[model samples]
Target: MYTEENTARLLPDVAVHAQPHLVGELDWVGMDGIEVPVRFDAGDGDVQRASARVGAFVNLRRPDKRGIHMSRLYLQVEQALSTQTLSTATLRDLLRGFLDSHKDLSDRACLSIRFEHLVRRPALRSANSGWRSYPVTIEASMIGEELLLEFGTEIVYSSTCPASAALSRQLIQDQFAKDFDAGKAVEHAAVLAWLGSEKGIVATPHAQRSVARLRVRPAEGAAFNLIDLIDVTEQALGTPVQTAVKREDEQAFALANGGNLMFCEDAARRIQKALDADKALSDFHIRVEHQESLHPHDAVAYASKGVEGGYAGKGCA
Candidate 1:
């Protein structure tokens, strides 16, 4: 068996860090798509353990260093995640560990984690419920001793076009006028039957599937409130997609969509207003996309909290 001392003597050890000829500081260097097991808090005092895809990086401040200890960064992430719950404090510790491991070479560290968060959603008008998965991403960066945390998620809903709805009402009114006679008594049952017939309902509004993607940074010392943000968004939109559905639930969903006719601009503003009301969030960026049924392309709008030097209203592609 070869010992550590014998191996070092037999092998050529290249001092890459000592090479001054190839000296240049790198903005970022490390690993991406690293698989790790992490524990997440569901904001209800429940802890969920799941596998997540992670990315870890650090900025090389030393010009003479050839490269960073990539394996050390990976190990640090694994160790930190295995020992702590997922939160702002956990992320700050993990990022600090990255810099600690590369003390002489790096001064700034960053980490990103992506996972699918599953939550149970009840039916609109039924006793049953089902699980819905939301794509979530958590990112953190540490520069010196300051750490910034960001959270992102996506919500899918229905958007009924306001223009199409008005047009449809006009057509229905025209159909009803043609079916009825001027100054004539109409039977209640006959009118009800006519309203249910195809001729009476000549047109229907066009509604399309829409998505709201948001990224937010919570205020300092505030806990990460993922479920609270989700609730606020769904309530503000008023037509979130349902998981479990019976006939009654389907009917309730239809009524909800009919009542909440909106354009892409409307959805974006609703989310912006809801986020503004939450004191826990300090900065945010939101984008709502209406996959138009009338047009081949999608209509999109963006909004932000407009904090100085914070996130701009950018598209989430």
Candidate 2:
């Protein structure tokens, strides 16, 4: 019953997208919080599938256009992500698709995908292992013909205040001097009993949960190495929060914290040094936050590769 003429009359062709606009070229116009399934190559012959929150955008070069085809961006993102394993090459193609769909309306496009990356981490002193979720984000942008990619992640660890540790040690030494006369003969049993008593540890250093947020851009032809970057950061900090821990593991963690006392400055510097040694990352920005147990506010430090037009080393908090 539906002929071509009747169908054309029933649904009229609308040109709302070509409506006149007053503004000039807009910087970015697109959609955010689009839920999509993405596949990632783990670099070890493994592929990880995750549901991610995606943001897609493009620079609207034509001021006369009413708006960009937002649904087109979403559809392109969904199709590409569902079909291909994410990589620099695939991401470039995806962004290119954004421009292709828009054609003469846009020349620059950007995409941001955020998800939690899970890895099984072994206990510090136990045979057990548990999954740890690291919050991660991948950002890709194409300006004209140039494509830029950045990988970011957040790592949580323990930071013991170096100044607080030194002060605690001083107090403990003073307590020990008071408990046992320096010139008197120190008996083994008496020293052991004193060490076991509450008076022995007159003070304790303040340690608190800390976080390191890092964003890095890999060099040309380099792959996005999320796991490697996480490992390097955790190793440098020396006190990543554990998932499964027995008494021995807890003690080992305590020992690690004690040995690697750091202020926010130290934490940032350690990560900076480690990242600098890595050849894969061409530019990076690091922010370390020491949630102070002694103060109401947190202590924070930020560092960035001193490259021209690189990250500005701004603190997120």
Candidate 3:
């Protein structure tokens, strides 16, 4: 089927290939948040004390005609390691540079960093306390001239379910009363024996592990303190976890748990209202996951941080 002209064209070698007339649309997908460990705050303290790690997400843009440069993202982050100064402001600057590096395709960018911000505290009784870290994090995004910033912390609180414990007490009381009302009043020895048996044991209520996740978008020139959210969340949970716990502190923790028995659902609702009432956050995604011991499955519930979606008070919460 070959002609003289076609054979001549097919055999010739060329230095250039034809350029594309059009390009395809690309989805610049990414892993939004990843926990990374690196040395942070290394200039002022001992190596052990100075050791710090923070989670971060890099901004990326996919090419319409070809592919995205993934290795470049990793290179930028690895460079931050030796520099050692990473703050909210520094992160903002870094992201802008990232976006500008790939301006031909994508128009939006996002980044999130999670890390433990530590503080040293003295022991309650002994002078033997060390350092404890709090979960501190930041999230940011840029689309054209518009910018979004968010920050938060996650804290643990123990709350005991009072209703469940009260029922246990009532059941024990009824059993004692019925025994006393019988033809023969129960003897002290017999009562003592009953108390030693499983039949007379009172079931203590279970405590719940609660988490508070908050996101905020502050006005221009406004200061959004992440610690403020930490304080509010710990308070909302009733009892915050202690960094240094002696016998007395342990007892106090137990007492707090005995008083606040909340299911995973209770924790979510309480936190949702707290954020809703606050003027700081208006649109957020709030999720609480409860790891259960009684069952193999975990209980979870979610609420949007600052939206007007009707809360139906359904399912677990």
Candidate 4:
């Protein structure tokens, strides 16, 4: 029978501890897509467990070391993340553990976890609610005593084209003028009947499902308030997609869309203004995409807090 002593004699660490043929330092060396169980505070003191895909990395400072302890990284992620609620402090400690394991082999470490955050949303003008899942990514890195944390989430909502609304209003006016002759005194009943008819409202503004990808660098000592950020963004947009709806709720949603006509630029600017006012977020990047109903292409806009050396105001991050 195979025993521990015999197994140890049979397998050696030659390959793992071997020196690299090309002796040059790598910027980062580690593994990704490690399956891990994580928990986070989802507002109101509620702790939620989620399945997360983790990426862990540490700098390869030693030119002679060919490889890192991949198993060590995986174990650290599994043990640390599974036991603690994911937060800035937990992430910082996790990254520090990474560097500690690699010791002289690395000076910096990074960790990322991606998962779906589920929230219960109440229907507009209804006594019902449903669950919505938001894709969220939390990333942390520790480099030379400086720890950075970034939170990213995707928010799905509705966007109505402003230009399309204007054109639709013009068409409706033209239809109304055709029904009633100029300088003719129309009866209230006739006008109301006509307004109720399909021919009366001949056009509608094109609205489509839109997505907002937001990445924010929280201020120092700020807690992970994921739901708060989501609520702020959805409130600013004012047209978040509904989970459950009745006719009344549908009508209310339509009214909201009518009142909140926006282009991609408008969505981005609205989110920018809201994030700028948030004291918890020191820097942020916003990318809003309107999946156009009138055209095959999507309309996109990008914005940032204009923080120096932060977000750079370019991509969605």
- Each candidate's clash count: 0, 0, 6, 0
Kindly list the per-residue Cα lDDT of model 1 for residues 133-240, writing each as its tens digit. 988899999999999889999999999999999999999989888889868998999889998899877999999999999899989888767788889999999999
lDDT of 2 by residue, 67-136 (tens): 7888889999999998888899999999999999999799999999998878888999999989999888
Model 4, residue 70: what's the lDDT? 82
Superposition TM-score, candidate 4 onto the true structure: 0.95
Single out the weakest 10-residue window by summed lDDT for candidate 2.
Answer: 12-21
Ranking by TM-score: 4, 1, 2, 3
RMSD of each: 2.0, 2.1, 9.1, 1.7
- Candidate 4, residues 5-51: lDDT per residue as tens digits? 79878766763564656787889888899998899886658889999
> Residue 49, candidate 4: how far off, in angstroms?
0.7
Which digits, one per residue and each the tens of the lDDT, describe model 3 over residues 38-118? Answer: 443322342222233433333333323344444444555556533545544556665665566557545666666666767
TM-score for each of the candidates: 0.94, 0.94, 0.66, 0.95
* Residue range with the least summed lDDT across 10 consecutive positions in model 1: 11-20
- Which 10 successive residues of model 4 have the least lDDT summed? 12-21
Top-TM-score candidate index: 4
Candidate 2 ranges beyond 4 A from true positions: 1-21, 312-317
State each model's CA lDDT, in order. 0.89, 0.90, 0.58, 0.90
